[model samples]
Target: MDLQLPRGMRDFPPEEKILRDEVIAILKNLFELYGFSPLETPVVERWEALSAKYSGGEEILKETFKLTDQGGRQLGLRYDLTVPLARFVGMNPTIKRPFKRYQIGTVYRDGPIKKGRTREFYQCDADIVGSSSPLADAECVQLALDVFERFKIDVVVKINNRKVLYELVRAAQIPEKFTEAAILSLDKLDKIGPDEVIREMVERGIERTSAERFLSGAQDPQAFKNSEGYRELEPVLSALRDSRVVWTPSLARGLSYYTGTIYEVYAKDSSVTGSLAAGGRYDNMIGQFLGGTEKIPAVGISFGLEPILEVLKEQRRDLPLRKTVTQVYVIPFKTLVAEGRAVCQRLRRAGIKTDIDFSAKGISDGLKYANAYAIPFVVIVGPDEVAQGKVKLRDMRSGEEQLLTVEEVARQVAQRLS
Candidate 1:
C-alpha cells in the first residue's frame, strides 16, 4: 500500500491542524465583524460554467482540474471562490442587491506547486456584488489591510485601476485585439524586467516602440487625467486612508476578469514571495454568467490561506505549540474517577476546553500524559480533596501545585487561560 501523499498534498497533524484551525477561527470572526455574511457553495461546478463564465484567462483555465462524471456530465473543481460567487449571483435573480458575502473553502489548481502555492488549497474570500461604486473597491482593500494587521503581518498594498492601465495601453498604440495580451506581458514587469516585458509585448505582435511607451506610461498615472479609469480611481485612492496603500499604474492584476480597481498585498520584511491576498473589481464576469453585457459590478479580496499559513509558520511567535486544544487535564484517584468526570463536565459546561483521563492512572502517568500534549493545567482529585470539595491544581509549566476549592480552581484556570 502507498503511504506517501500525492504531489503537493500534505497531512496537517494535530499540532499543525490546530494552528490552522485557530487562524480560520480568527478570520471567520473578523469577516463577520467587518459586516460580511458567511456563504457556502459547491466545490464542483459544471464544466461549462467553470470554463466559460470564470474565464480569468488562458493561464488559469490551463490549470483547471477537468473531469467527466459517470452520468456523462462534464465537471471541474472550482479554482477560486470569486468565480463561484459570480455564478451564484447570476443564478439567483431575486437575491438582494449589493449582496455582501464571505466564504472560506478549498479550491483546486493544477498549476506550479511552490512553497506558498499548491494543487489544492483553501481560499478565504469576501466580496460585494451588484455595486459599482469605487468605495466597494476601497472597502475590499481595507478588509485585506485589516486582515494582515490582525495577523501581525506588516504589508504594503499596490492599488491600480484596470481602466487606468487600459488607457495607458491605448496611449501606447496597442490595438484593442492586443490589449489583454499586452497587459499580461506587462504584468511580468516586476519579475522579468523591462527588456523581457518589451520582448513579451513584441512577441505578442506589439511594436517595440509601443511596448516601451506602455512601460514608461506605467510610472505616471496622471498622464491619463481625462480617461474614465483615472476619474474612477481618484476617489478610491482618496478613500483609502491607510499609509500602506499606493497607486501603481502598471499593476495589472494578472487576471482577465479584473476590469477596474485591482490590488495585491505583499508582506514587508518577510521571506514570502507571493501576495498574502489579492482581489479586484471584476464588473463583467457576472454579466457573462447572465449572458449579457449588463455589468454587475463586483469587487472582492481573497486571503490565500495557505500563504497566510506559511507566514504564520514563518513568524512562529503567534503560532501556539500545543498539540491539543485541551486547556486543562483532569486525573482522579482510582476510587474517584466519577468525581473527576463530574469536574470535567463542569469545566466543559463553562465553555473551557477540558480533557479527562478515564483510565484512572497513577498521578505520575497522568501528569506525564498532560505534559506530553502541553496541557497547561492538571486537576488532581483524590479522596481527601474530594471530601473537602477542593482539588490540587498543578501548573505543568511551573511545577507549582496549589490546593484550592473546585470553584477557585475553575476561576483561576478560566482567568489564566482567558
Candidate 2:
C-alpha cells in the first residue's frame, strides 16, 4: 500500500521549510519589539469550550473536526487561535492583567479545500488583552504595517467596525437576529456581486425588501458614508486624525467574534489576489468562555503565512535571505587535525562561525570544498605552518592567499566578515 499524507495536508520541503522558518523568525522579532509576549494553547480542546464561543452564528461548528478521545470525552482541533487564546486567559487568571501576547502555531479546520485555503495551516497571531481603547486597535494596525514593511511588501489595510455593520443592518430594517447572516453575506461581497449578495441574504431568511435595501444602500459609498455606521466612527476617526491611514467602509470580516473594528490587508492592486493578512477586534469572545466575570478586552491580527508566501512566490520575490555566518573553514593535515580543530574552536569562542574539514582531504580539495559551500575564507594548516605557529588563509572568492598567525588570521577574518 502506498502511504501518503491526507488530502489538504502538505509536507514542506527543505527550501519551503527554511522560507517558513525565516518568516516566523522575522515575525517573532517584530512581535517582541512591539512588547507582545508569547502564549501557546493545546491543539485539541473540549468541543464545548471551543464551539460555544463562535456562536457568532457562522458555519464554523459544521466545519470543525469533532471526535471522541479514548476517555470518551468530546474534543476537536481548534479552528483558530483566538478562541484558544480566550480559553487560556480564562484558565490562567493569575497571568498579568492587560496581557500582551503573540502565538504562532498550526490550526485545523475541516473547511472546503481551495487555493490558499487548507484543512490545516499555521496562523501567526498577536493580540492585546484587557484594553478596549482604539489605541489598542491603532497599535495592532501599526504592528501589522511593520510586518509588511519588514517583508518589503506593499499593502493597503482596510478597516471597519462591526458596530458599524450592525448599525447599517439596523438602518436597512433588518432584524437584529438576521444581522449575522447579513454580515456573512456582506463578507462575500468581494467574491459575489451585489445581486448575489441580495439573493444570499434573502435565502438566509432575510426579507426581500430588507435585503434589497441593505444591498442597494451599501453599494453607494455616499449612502454608506452618511449612515449610522459613519456616525459611530466620529470618535475613532477624530483620534486617528493625526495618524494618516486609508479608510474603507467595505472591510467587514466574516468571523463571529469580532464586535468592533475589523480589518483586512490587501495587496496594493486588488487584482493581485488573496488577502495577504487579516484580523479584527473581538471584544466579547472572552465572555463566552469566562461568562463575563473577567474583564478581558482583546484585539489582534494574524498573518496568513501561506497565502503571503504564495503571493511572494507568484511575484518572484525573495524573502530576506539569511547568509550562513561562517567566517572560516579550517583545513589541516590529518596529523594536525587536533590543532586545526583547536584553532576553529578558539575562533568560534571569539564569536565567529568557523568549521574544520574532518575528511582529512588535501589543501586543494579542502579549498574546493570551501568554495562549494560558498565559504569565503579557508584556513590551511600543514606541518610547516603548524611548526611555525602560523596558518595560510586563502580567500575563496578572490583566490588570494596569505600567511598569518592564529590571532592575526582571526582578526582579519572577523574584520572582513563583519
Candidate 3:
C-alpha cells in the first residue's frame, strides 16, 4: 500500500507551517493597513464561472483541474483569487464602486512544477474594483513595496503596460490575430534567451522577422513612449519614481485580462525562479460577467505565500523557526503536576503561549524536551519554588536563569518578547 500526496503537492510540517503562517500574518496586516478589506470565496467554483471571460486568461486554463460533482455539475478548484473576486462582484452588482478587498487562501494549479511553482499553494491578493485610475495601480505598487520591505527581502519591482506591449507587437509587424500568442511568448523573454524567445514565437506561428524585431524593442521601455499604454503607465511610475522601481517594458503578465499596467516582483540576486508577487489592472473581466452594460475597472496584486516562505527560510536562517508557538515550557518537579498546571494557567491568562509537561520529568530531561521543541523559556516548578511563590525561569538560548516571583516572571518574559 502506498500513501502519498499527488504530484506537486506537499504536507507542511510544523516548522514549515509556522514559517508560512508568519508570512500570512505580515501580508494580512499590510493589506488591511492600506484600506483593503478582507474577502473570502469558495474553494470550488462553477465550471462556467471558472471558464468565463472574467477568469485568469487562457494560459492558466490549461492548469485548471476540472471535476464533476455527484449532482453532475462541473467544478474546478480556483486557480487564482482575482477571477473569484470578479465573479463575486459580478453577481452582487451593487457592491460599492472602487471596492478595495484582499483575500488570502489556497489556489490550485495543475501546471508544470519548478523551484518556486507548486500545484497547491496560497495567494494573498489585494484588489480595487470600479476604478481605472493609475493611482489605484500606484497604490498597489506602494503596498507591494511595503510588503517586501517588511519581509526584509531585497526585490526589484517591475512595471509594464499591456497596452504598450500591444503597440510593440504592432510595430514589429506581428499579425493582430496572433497578438495574445505573441505576448505569451514574449513573457518568456527573461526566462529564455532572446533567440529562444524568437524561436518560440516563430513556432507559435509568428514570423521570425517580426518576433526578432519585437524582442529587441520590448527590452527597451522607451521604444513605446508614443503609445497610450506608455502614457497610462506614466502616472504610476511617476508616483513611485523615488521608489527605485524599474520600467520593465516586456513584463507580459501572461494573462489576457490585463488590460493595462502589469506588475511583477522578483527577489534581487536570489535563486528563486519566478515572481514572488504580481498583478495588474484588469478592467474588462468583471464587465464580461455583468453582461457588458457597465464598466467595472479593477487592479490588484497577489503575493505567493509559498515562494515568500521559501525566500524567508533561505534568507533568514538566523530567525528562530520553531515547531510550536509556545513561549514557555513548564516542567513539574517530581509529582508537582498540579502546581505546574496552576503556573501554566497563570501564564496562559497573561496571553503567554504556555505548555506544561503533564507527566513530571527530571529537570534535565525537561530542559531537553523544551529545547527539542524549540521552546525559548523553561519554568522549573518544585516543592521549594511552589512554597516560595516563585519559579526558576531559564532562557534556553543563553541558559541564563533567574529566580523570580510568578508576577515578575510574566512581566520579564512579556517585556523580552515585545
- What is residue 348's positional error in candidate 1, in angstroms? 0.7
Write model 2 residue lDDT over 1-418, tens digit each, in one string: 9999998899986557767888899999999999999888899988887777543345777788889999999998888888889888877777776788999999887878767778899999999988888788878878878888887778877777777677678878999889888988988888887789889999999999999887766665566666555654555556555333456665668778888777788776434466777887787777657777755678898888877777666565444332444568999998999999988887788777898899887887888777766788998888989888899998887989999988888888888877
Worst 10 residues of 3 by lDDT: 239-248
Instruction: Give the per-residue Cα lDDT of candidate 2 at 257.
Output: 84
Model 3 error, position 88 (Å): 0.6
Lowest lDDT 10-residue stretch of candidate 1: 50-59
Candidate 3 regions with alpha-carbon error over 4 angstroms: 318-320
Q: With candidate 1 superimposed using the best TM-score fit, by how many Å does residue 399's alpha carbon deviate from the native?
A: 1.4
Q: Which candidate model has the greater lDDT, 2 or 3?
A: 3
Error of 3 at 213 (Å): 1.9
Better of 2 and 3 by TM-score: 3
**How many steric clashes between backbone atoms does each model show?**
0, 0, 0
Badly placed stretches (over 4 Å) of model 2 are 1-3, 54-57, 113-117, 207-209, 226-234, 238-244, 269-272, 311-329, 361-377, 392-418
Q: List the residue pairs that clash in candidate 1.
A: none
Best by TM-score: 3
